[model samples]
Target: MSADPAAPRLSASGAHFSVWAPEASHVWLCLFDADDRETRMPMTRGEGGVWHSEATGVGAGARYGYRADGPYDPAAGLWFDPDKLLLDPYATAIDRAFIYDSALAAPRGEGGDTAPMIPKGVVEAPLAPLSGALPCFRPGGLIYELHVRGFTMLHPDVPEAQRGTIAALAHPAVIAHLQRLHVSAIELMPINAWIDERHLGPLGLTNYWGYNPVNWFALDPRLAPGGIAELRETVAALHAAGIGVMLDMVYNHDGESDAEGPTLSLRGLNARDYFRHAANGQLINDTGTGNAIACNQPMVRRLILDSLRYFVTQARVDGFRFDLAPALGRMADGFDRRSPLLEEMRADPILADRVMIAEPWDIGPGGYQLGHFGDNWLEWNDRYRDDMRRFWRGDSGMLGAMATRLAGSSDIFSGAMTRTVNFLAAHDGFTLADVTSYEQRHNHANGEENRDGHGENLSWNNGVEGPSDDPAVQAARRRDHIALLATLFCSRGTIMLTAGDEFGRTQQGNNNAYAQDNAIGWVDWAGRDTALEAEAFALAALRAGNADLRGAAILRDADVAWLDESGAPLSVAQWEDPQRRRFALHYRGSGLAICVNGDGEACKFLLEGQAVNVAARSVRVIPPAR
Candidate 1:
């Protein structure tokens, strides 16, 4: 386990606040009143670079900030300004949302005091023990990825007051929708409090994705009306419904950008220790968010682990999906799978049983650590996404790759037990409907022209781009969409479906809709799209009813036979053939034969010694002659 830096302990009498600022000459605790007035008191410096202070009047519900008097040197990566108020790195709750201003990020000479404008931290009362038994999340369970606001913001059945709040999602109508798909877990995308990026002001956009975080521990007020209590109630409700919750967490970077970025919390408290920097003190742009968090540091590791365990014990969350997890495992040497933070999470007494998922890649050097997260950790397989896309889009020479992903990507994740969290669409990319209905990403609304999203989406338009009135093209898009989702569910390991992808949700070809908070990003519940919804339920039912598909252990070669159209396992020469796209997969134990045609035209397959013709860009599921 990493060294415990358990400072800022709270008690009934008052709060014990301790900060690690070795360079500071003096430090003061600034307690704020309801009227926005601050009562400043000097803090004494302790051993090991920690400054400690305890105030009898300051307790839970008190709003406070910090003032550290240290050298104003940016060249050495120290930017301590007494006039600028800083947030506690261990703060449990924040008073309000972060409102970014240009003056907050400027150098001391160029900028003035931001305390008046910056949000203050609020000390929260300790949480009560959870009421009811929680659902246990494990491999092979279905995950429904959603955004709290967008998931219920426009939900017709949800009350207007509850719209866009955590409680809104726990409504019976919303839970029924989740229950319809048998979602064993819900992966909420970043409910943590975050500040809008400075660049978005001019474009009149907001950080709808909640990736740019200012407070790691506070829940976004917009998403949680009653704050942490509201979230706990929601989780308890979901647990009662037999569904677990997994939070999508961002520890890779802070809302603070490069040198010109805001001081916010950690950056203002201790920039050098909180974030990664080169030998010359320049910030490392690993997360592409300006500054990458130095998770290798003991203090930062404590922050992450402490926050995780807090959610488990206080909020009763089942697991977490770490965003750009490579940043957490990075070191001065390079990316290490056995880094202290990773080891701590794996061995932590509280976190060991929790479901740990990794995004698996970052923008740093050797950042792509897919299939390298050791054991007991599942990964979002980009290989599954790409191969499934290429094969279904009628791209030739991909049959072998497609076969590998369907069988749990043994070529990549070959540790015996399946750790692949396979999905055709997630929150970050194009929807399953859009992937087959559009060729190019139309991200004009992002205000970055059309250069914002991924260039190569490996998508197909099915003879028409974006929304098409052509019935033939629409039918083809629907066919491809259902097939892609079916493929995802039929694959080994766990399967995740985006909230509206099952019902043919479209972002109008906008792959990266992170900034758009309007109707463009919200799920379309008005249009029921019953056909695609049924396909989703069919896939869920297929996984639940078929033991072979959701095998506890990795399916052995004898369990499945990847056969050619002639109803026989493909020969070495046939498997290598680029023109080979039509194949029948037979689950030997389950007596299920599925014929997948990836060709541009329909193909005939001999199933159970009986000839059957399958359409192009489609999948045919049949009982093996009963």
Candidate 2:
């Protein structure tokens, strides 16, 4: 079940329970009945800090938890409390979703038994490993990132009972929509079991993004009522439709915050080895979530690797995008490309071929390790997002930068093939529509006094801030949207588009809507722009039809040419001109070319003996001459 073989495994006799609590004075396996009563079974200490116990009649669907009693010294990071019921790190299912309470975080002796408040790990017999299934997604394909709850919550066709659940994704309407966009994969934001932040309860808010995960293997009951089975079925459905599934995993930190946080699972078992700490005995705040996972530790690495293997073999997911990925590659020496955990994942037979993308940054020291992830990894390129935004905003001297990004940011990635995942907007920042309508983040609703999100969004208001009734302003915004989408599809390497961005979804200027689990966070299906959606579909088709646009390799000198309006090769002066906006890229022998007009007025570009009229603030895919 694990490196130390600690997770509950079913046996012919009954069920076997084990856990690793190195310094605990005593540990008890807490078994609960249908009426919520608990039975304590003492465990025997074994080699390597493992505690083992056998239940003669325990079987699948039985709810259980662990209680480790030991030194409760906060300074030393030994947070063991028998009163706090701890979850199993390898649990595949849970009886209920976690709801935070002040008592859960109360001091070791001050708190009462949390058995009723905490969720118990439900014993589940493992499903047979999915065989003969390979990932359906390839790099340089469209990755549609969406929150499972937010994406399906407002869908009119989805049944009321299925809304906001993983099963809803398998509904015909959702699958049809993904097929329309030619989505290569659906990158689901964290679906693992998570808990609300401590401060969120007071403000009547919750962590809508599911970044604060509590257990790695358990599916949050709020999203997946059927647990791992639901996920497996949905994945099978997506695979049947030729779509892949990618999970946004949060291994950097757990929902357990600082010293004052609850002793849910890892903290109660072994916080000293599970989480990173400074020499002064304080938790390291690398993830900005009050604690950073000690991924460098042997046992912690084993647990993470086991979780990945479980998802791949059981759920048949395509790959993973690591949130705050620097933590996984971090050690006492800081972020390293050759970190042990990273190496193991790349070399592991189960995970070696899976797509591994990185957020590539954290708030830790030397945390931004963008292009340093080495080969076999794709990174979320903020440079592509920022540069593309700046260029379309008509910022001077942005032509060169935009060209570089469109060509897959070869400067940042020095490999033969680029590993950049070019994207305009993702789950963290402003939606595509908000990027053109809001000049600043309106996050007052986040309860952070409007100071929570990114300050400089590289965004422009297009002559009007927020929603505008002015016809000209609205028209300009639409044009900008089309132009931005065309640039993305025409770019090299893998590309990601947020779920609602194609149809003009907005957060009402609230860039940081992580706390808004209501209407603000849900995708507005009724209000989507049909024309813009059609435009995105056409762009996807165009990208799919052309090899040059989908190719990951950088364009060679012989294959592509940067030309002026007159169709001649561009000179250094023209390339360096800060005011230059109009340019054409001609791919020799491909019968396909692209013309970009960044100015506010339309212009004509001479291409292959014909003058092509290009609209202002737009990009045109010029066809070959007949």
TM-score of each: 0.96, 0.99
Writing each residue's lDDT as its tens digit, candidate 2 over 21-131 gives: 889989999999999989999988888898888899999999999999999888989888889999988788899999999889988889898998999999999999986
Error of 1 at 391 (Å): 0.5
Worst 10 residues of 2 by lDDT: 1-10
Cα lDDT tens digits for candidate 1, 1-626: 11223435577677777777777888888888989988998988787677788888666788888888778888788998887888877777778888888888888767777788788888777687553343467798888999999988889999999998899978999988888888889999998888888899889998999999876778888888588899899988998888899999999998988888888778777888988889888999998889899998987888888888888878889999999999878988888989999999999877888889999999999999999998878899998999999998877788888887888888777767889999888998898898988888999999999999898898989887788899998888888888898788778888888989989988889999999898889988887588889988888887777766665366668778888888888998888888888787888776687788887788888867788888887877776444
Give the alpha-carbon lDDT of every model. Answer: 0.84, 0.91
Best-fitting candidate, measured by TM-score? 2
lDDT of 1 at 581: 86
TM-score of 1: 0.96
Off by over 4 Å in 2: 1-3
Off by over 4 Å in 1: 1-12, 129-135, 611-613, 624-626
